[model samples]
Target: MDNKAVEALTEAEAKAELAQLAGALAQANILYHGQDAPGISDSEYDALKQRNALIEARFPKLKRPDSPSEQVGAAPSEGFAKVTHVVRMLSLSNAFDGDDIIEFDERIRRYLGLGDVAPLEYTAEPKIDGLSLSLRYEAGKLIHAATRGDGAVGENVTTNARTIAERVAEGRKLPDIPLLIDGAPDVLEVRGEVYMSHADFADLNTRQVARSDKQFANPRNAAAGSLRQLDSAVTRRRPLRFFAYAWGELSAPLSDTQMGAIERLNDFGFQINPLTALCDGPAGMLAHYDKIEQLRAALGYDIDGVVYKVNDLSLQGRLGFRSTTPRWAIAHKFPAELAWTHLEAIEIQVGRTGALSPVARLQPVTVGGVVVSNATLHNQDYITGLDSKGQEIRGGKDIREGDWVQVYRAGDVIPKVANVDLSKRPEGSAVYVFPDKCPECGSPAIREDGDAVHRCTGGLICPAQAVEKLKHFVGRAAFDIEGLGAKQVEQFYLDGWVKEPSDIFTLGERFSSGLQQLKNREGWGEKSANKLFQAIEEKRNIPFARVLFSLGIRHVGEQASNLITRNYTSWPALITAMDAAAACEGVEWDNLLGIDGVGDVMARSLVMAFAPGPERDSIDKLTGHLNIEDAEHPDIDGSPVAGKIVVFTGTLEKMTRAEAKARAEALGAKVSGSVSAKTDLLVAGPGAGSKAKKAADLGIETIDEDGWLQLIDGL
Candidate 1:
């Protein structure tokens, strides 16, 4: 209800307290999220977070918005042309109790058809509490260091990385710090935990105390807070050490042995964790987890839980990745940290596409160690607790404002809305209903049939829709108009120079004399504005594919737009075809539908967007600025991936799947769906799946990703 603030502490005192709090919180959060192990109790960590927030609030000037209180840690560095994590890091569906773990064991067995196979092998070690860093080593030299920002693209912190490398390389002060870049090899992205021992954390805090300085609450926080320092030297001074867990891009082969791999990494100068081991199977893995769990109270450094990875490199390659994580691995975490808080209120946030998403405001509570005030409500149906009363019911539970709710973070990211305490609900509260009208423009909203999202129909008039539309029209994914980022778009809209997608084209004529003034502003210059105008001109001649996607058609994405453009060959041809077949049935859609992944849904989306609606004027306006469409579909008769609804899974020993897909499209085979009766062949690599089964059921042949490559090789 009130901003909890603390009296101002001196600079040294603040530093000491911050360091201590950082270390402690980091340790607790690591155990709770990463290892599924719990060290300190949830209540204890919350107390520390409360203290941290109060301190931060009281001395607002001393507070860094990038502080632990506000930021989601630091973003990983991107100096070397960035590499997307092939495997998205994901958490296992949890079991709060021992029964849950047992059930997880059973599910794995059921899915893998391992009836009574020797018990699962898990390599349980202390889940170190610290910032997760991805290190790329080519031939074994540390090339990059990044924070696990969004699990996708992180900030490029090569400056701090180089500092850490210098310190570790010189072996001057902190001799025990981890080092994976011996002489700097090729690109190998290795991920691990960076931590300071609890004793060291305490010692660091004690020195501060002796100097009348603030003390760190714990070791984990110390590690996380220390490493994120913008100045690499500031980070280097901290007694930070790294304990590697996983890997990304690698060059020369690692060792043949799993344990040997860790040993080799250590030899290459990486500080592999002392506790990692090679367990036979599930039994060994569980046993390790049990031993680690049993030692919960006392450990050299703060570790929340343990990580168990399969020992076989080849099997790991076979398992590959899911939407965001790896199939070969799962963090078999111990019981996670949980906290209960009251749901204060719920608000609706309109996405760029006009879809209304639910956001929940909760009585701030510390889950793990971070204070969470907001949680995603998922969707309208979810907000109404619709599924709770239906087939997906969780014992008919419901969410109401003021009801006590459980909250926890999984895999150190994505805080979830857990169960709620209905008994504590406040009176007069009813189900949170999604609005039927656009909050921005008051136009009626509609929930399209096949989708779960409820979208606003106020296409041109809605402020939210207009701003987002203008932004998208100049977005990297769209026109890629340089100097026209969201800020510029917002300014233009506020200045009335732009509104719909078409308005972007008129900016040149609208403010040619004034346009020169933009150069004098903060980030502007003559060169910059000229560059922007030049970029704008370059994009005037729109590619048919980009233009289609840029039009902001509902279901049409970059890839889908490309598909339609290819089938139609040119924009005029595509428009004419759509117009002629406007009233045509499935029969008409099928004529153009033979294009890979094209269907009625897609055809209708195009017809509706380009159809003469009120937004039509905006399209016409775009013409003045946009270059004429210059794209024609290539002859598809010779393409390789063409008709093969290709689904790539598991690891390919060769090139990345992105490179592979691009290569496949160059040839003339129409890539089919994700594997069905229509699919000519299912790429059945090491981790071939339910899709492969469905393919087989439909009598479709299955091939490894490699075999698929071979089939189209030299085409």
Candidate 2:
């Protein structure tokens, strides 16, 4: 967007832009930090953030609640144990151009009351585009290393860190400093970036492709994935290198100045950025930035930007911090790469829920550091130039087959079409039309009103939907059956060995008695087939919640299934309730609808699935073959909210309604939507009228969101 156009945006336009920026940044964070795969380039991410900051500055009052300005990296994945940092590892403010750096310096001088009389020195270093780590050393011996998760907390990856290189190996590389540095403090926390060099990254990708494994998106992602490995052996195989740029908690100070501290760190046998230098002022900083930018292509490792920090420790302390960033530093980011690729064709994939996702098959091209052949089209609207709100985007232009389009990947793992180069359009090209029918089963694919996706209405009858459902059934969140994946399920389905969920339990008996022996298959051995059968048999006694989710009922996700199971406690009780609810709209139906977040749509979907039909029959047959355990709720001993049905109404001031429900549920409470005779507590927020009055009239205990929080404070 042009500067004039950005300056002239209306309040509503700014607000809309902010929402889009927030969503994009959040998704980018998830891809970068959680999945270790960045969909977008660092420059693109920085640009988005810069745009968001500009918009927020323009209309401060219109700032969204989930602004990227207030956030750090994505929340850490659940696989690692979270380590809270004693001193917060805050992110730096961004600078897009030389003018931004000048402004930053001037702002710093004004804040410090220096009046440009004294030369304020700064340290400019290459900002490594890799995973951030904080290593703790006690008595100069390396203890633990953690990844910078959300700035305040991180994932403990000490074992993974050790796999990079043992203390002996690392110590042998540097004769200046031993494993135990002499006269070092009892405790020292050195913060740095863990990165994979370009050569190593390419070598790793080569090995990955050779082994037929999924190639990493980039060096940063490869480094992150390697460093966060639960298995140290996997990390040990990757060629990961580290560069110490800063420090956290320290028993004693290393040096008085930033450059001195870095020098001290280098002396302690840690790799520091070679480009690290002391800059006189903004001019020096810009000069260094330009030099680094020119050398970026030749750098052995990824460096997204150059970081400029106040050289003096005292000055940095005085400069202090903004809400989410430090005033003492800023990262000047580089530009993103864009390449024109031919859009060969568009393919549609039918998901378990029947949503048809469009994927663009493009001529292989390199964007940034990753090769791209496929990109997500999101939905039909995205291809035709209309957004989710039906707003005209890209001048109402639609992408076409055989057309040259600019593809770019920001932190997004999936490459996206930035723009279509219409000048190079293929002669006599026609607008690509989305399929109205499912390719796999000839089922009529229909788009529901207000929904962007086109879905196959054939349900279980569609082979595509059936296979997708079966895959989800045995997914990690579901049955998670060993030796049974999408490939295995498809094979079994083709061989008529498994048709429904019940068939999985009877596989051993079928193979033992039938003429078609399991060991006769090309890939099958007696032991392997027996192992598969044994795995299936072990999963026969499943949890009720897992059983409910494994059915692949539409709109009944893991959490909703858990809620239903907890409410019913048993498979029989839940089936009986669902069956009764399906017969007619009565108390049972209302009761199902009363579950918090379970509205008319989800309730209807559940009841329809349970209605007397083949779906119910299949579910019943599966249930007959399994010993399903009743739902177990954690006991909140001596807690007032335990096992009580609670309803929340209106806009909560202290917390989101979803958060409220989650907290209440965590405290062993059944959070419902509407006030009812069964409701033990009513959390009525401001603007709550009907539900509040109803609760009051029904003689139920009514409280505000704060009151509810107070009740569950200890528990």
Candidate 3:
């Protein structure tokens, strides 16, 4: 229990403990950061960590500065602002096979005074796929957010920090527990992951496609992209959520045990994994790990493995950290989900939303970490053989369901029929015919002009549209009603608790008592319910621009929203204008021509939404329930780049480059692309490159960033 025991540790015992710490910490780091899996549950890993920390405390002479117990992940990144991590983020070790597991157990036995009879415990939970970010809260406001760059210093991303505000607020999520610290108006750095929702990722990709922008490979990439935007406004538009699991700096100790700490974090608003549990000892830990293995398919998001941490902080200190990781934790990875099956046939299906998706039928294969015989093909052009005649070649289906098919996860998810063996096709199999009617709503499917996608005009009455619309209405981009997550929205719609956006505002009034029941749930209480209600109230007042975008009108984006807002002046004005415009027999060509980017298709779509029915009624009803932002001209009068494409190629002496660009955008300059004959003037600096050269080549005069600043001052 103290130093005397450690002083008497046999040479083998000392080596064993240190080795255990090294392997465990390394593995945990890999599982959690690299692969998104943990071999041990957070609680179990915490206990092991505490044990190591205690061991180190008793033997200060033997302590290593690089010990997992002492170190955090890495330093701050360079692109964004810098935030010093008050509490160092430690790394973890992991194990990929059973032999490593046995080795872990062997070291555990050697370190502790007890032999075979003294058992160890391990808890397990899914390792979520995400970016590790630390949030610092001063009082209840999120002041700083940083990434676990190497584990120590990190770039300051406060603007992006504001986007994940709900994750660190004590009123929203309880601060990490079992933390030892000092003070009031405390500053606590909460460690967690920022992830993009699957649906949101899809929508983002779709938008990117429409804009002719590059799409991210996965949600993790999407999250990173959103988090690193130079503009906080961009981050706010992203659907990034956080889940807390570790600690950095803390002014006070949170809980007695690791599980207790997580519970407290949940109390504070950090999303702790609900699947975590306490196991008796090593035997129990392994059993729980098996239990998780069984539930692998149902846990919604992607997970690489499970993490186990020692539970008690006091005991964790006894165990101590290695140079790279803590001895207390480990990650148990699930085997890759994969299968091979005959590609029965490839068919293209038109979705409710006009997306032309391809589907492949397989000879019932076990692929979903379970059995899945079918997978989506994504598009029509992916299935058939293209003809030189400028049409799809007939009689050559390219893929037939009865043929040999290679099945694998496309990006480790959404089982895909990767390739087909042409020789194995059944005799006389025919090419797939694209459907002309909606499968779910029975409406005639028609492809839009100048597009390959076939869309059904089912509107709001369609089942798919109904659910999707409700989700969009309550989404982070819209009303952001706290208690109404997507799943709850579906349940409410199905239960008739809500029929539209208005229905969401009425839930508290319609069934406040039922919500109180939610308070009694494992993680909720009266305080939580009240807090959720407060969050809802805070977001009740809507931004007409955001409301318009949230309506899911095709072709409308943030830029479009800005344009709409600039033109309408008020919600009523916007509505009236839309209605009047829609009533006209053709394009309001003269008025439409005034807007720079307004095109025929977008104009027509706007008319369609305003032509009115349920969508119109919903808009009117929503106005009655919420406050809209006051009509005002956007405040962009004095900033330097207000009306110019003033590119800063070199460092600025007046301010940091960030501040300079920010100031430039603040002015009326139309910050443009490459300068040309049309360029009014070029804001060139010391490092000005091709743009400045081109400006000179084009007879456009160039000014240093400072000279430009002076010009803006005059403006």
Measured against the true structure, the TM-scores of the candidates, in listed sequence, are: 0.64, 0.65, 0.45
> What TM-score, to 2 decimals, does candidate 1 have?
0.64
Candidate 2 regions with alpha-carbon error over 4 angstroms:
1-162, 165-194, 199-217, 221-237, 242-337, 389-391, 513-523, 648-666, 683-688, 703-715
Name the candidate that leads on lDDT. Answer: 2
- lDDT tens per residue, model 1, 1-715: 1231234344444433443454345434444433333433433344455456666556443432113443232223222233345533333222233443455456544434456665555444566767677766555545567666546545455565555555542233443333444543476676777777666777788877888965554566667666656666766666666776666656655765456667766666566666676676556666777877777667666666566555656545544443234444544445556778888887776655687766678887655545566665556655555431123333556676777887664333334466777777778878666788878888888876534556788766678877876766665446766567767888878777677776666556777765577777777888887777676667778777778777766546555676676656676677677766665655445555555555555566666666676755566567656555755434566555654455555555465554455455555444543554445656666666676677778887777866876787656
In model 1, what lDDT does residue 481 have? 67
Best by TM-score: 2
Ranking by lDDT: 2, 3, 1
Against the unseen true structure, what C-alpha lDDT does each candidate score?
A: 0.58, 0.79, 0.59
Q: Report the poorest 10 consecutive residues by lDDT, candidate 2.
A: 168-177
Ranking by TM-score: 2, 1, 3
Alpha-carbon deviation at 195 in model 1, angstroms: 4.9
**For model 3, how does the per-residue alpha-carbon lDDT over 1-715 read when each residue is reduced to its tens digit?**
2345556654334433543453345334434343332222233334344445656655443333224554344233324555556655555665554655666666654544336766455556777766778877776556667777556556667677566662343333433221222332376777877777667788888998999987765676677667767788878777776778877777777776778877777767557887888765566667777877787667545565678777876555545554447666777655444456777566554322334355676666543323455565433443565322224433444555566766553221234445666767678877667767766567776754434345667766665666767776775445656666667777767777777777767768888585666666665778877876787788777777777766766555444565566555578777766777877833343343234345454566676777768777876787787888844543575544443445455545555454454445445443443454546667666777787787788787778866766776754
